[model samples]
Target: MSGSFSLFIVGWGIIMIVLLAIGGFFMFRKFLKRLPKEDGKSILDWEEHYLELTRHMWGEDEKQFLEELVSPVPELFRDIARQKIASKIGEVALNKKQKQITRDTIIEGYIIATPKRDHKFLIKTLKEKNIDLRPYQSLFEQA
Candidate 1:
């Protein structure tokens, strides 16, 4: 009976060690992914730069609109999704050297940043808002 109990404890210890190793591996991988690239910019740095570039252009109304646009995302992920979409929109605005954030910029940025699977939600939302999508049809097709 003592030997059986000892074996059970050893087995449990082995399992716990394996689980910890797996967890540690994933944590290390995430750390690597956040490291700066050749451009000397990490993902977080790029996001911050984009946000700063377009900060002056975001009015309360535009903020509200962006929140509404990302409402379809699950509650837990909505904030991250919103940030990514906003960053992308800012990048788009910067690329176009726009003086202000236009509706087209918002839409284009949202479409570009989101995965193809989420395009269906975007299309439905745009339709509900009566926003014409002819301009982005090709982009949607490519996605």
Candidate 2:
């Protein structure tokens, strides 16, 4: 009876260990799956690509739009200004007059326009300000 009881206890312990090991393996696999897949690209590279893509798609007007949306405090305004300028240049239209007007309106809208409730207002304001938007330019350009 003592021998049988010891064998039973040993078998139960082994079973428990096996079950725990299986559970741990599954948990580890799940954790790996939750982690972001690395394409061997550095974060800075990804950021540059994202910025370039955004610049290609939205241009300067979008930068100004982001500034208005964020309303950086005085300390951060210079960085915002640089971004605004860069984005503007990135999206400048072919017609100089139209581009200037669009730039001016974006600035004016940021300063004077009421807090917009919808994103469409930004696009509408750009159009109303007579800015020509070429959204597809980035897609067509060869990287």
Candidate 3:
């Protein structure tokens, strides 16, 4: 009876260890999934939801709109738009070496396409998609 009881203890220890290992493995996998890729570029999880709204908003003109939306006034406001966008990009970026210059620059320039009073429309649209307009405000006087 003593030997059989000792064996049962050993078996229970093995079972507990296996259970802990399985739990640890799943936890580790979950952690790894949140980790960025080796290239330091990762698809943000919120992008899909944001993009869905943009798709609905832009419809067939998504690419064209994003393209022509920037500096739409051409030769007249081109330099003003460029300078304002660069200024806004500087504000949003933490440091000079920041890689986030392009996006906010474009958003700022897009704002230039609209009248100051109508800027709220674009801001509201972006806000609905969970996009923050604070970082993208350049053409406004207070930005």
lDDT at 11, model 2? 100
The TM-scores, one per candidate, come to 0.75, 0.27, 0.30
What's the candidate order when arranged by decreasing TM-score?
1, 3, 2
Q: Using lDDT as the measure, which candidate wins?
A: 1
lDDT of 2 by residue, 17-128 (tens): 9999999997786565445547865433443443464444445656556455444335634464344433443333322334333444344433332223433554464456
Could you tell me which residue pairs clash in candidate 3?
Answer: none
lDDT of each: 0.88, 0.48, 0.52
Query: Clash pairs of candidate 1?
Result: none
lDDT string, candidate 3, 1-143, tens digits:
99999999999999999999999997786576557777663333222323332332333443343444443436755554434433333443333344433555446545654567766666765565576766655456543
* Residue 118's lDDT in candidate 1: 74
Instruction: Assess candidate 2 and give its TM-score to the true structure.
Output: 0.27
Per-residue accuracy of model 1 over 1-143 as CA lDDT, tens digit each: 99999999999999999999999997897677579999998886788799988999887878888888999889977987898899999999999999888888899998898899878888999898899999999879876
What clash count does candidate 3 reach?
0
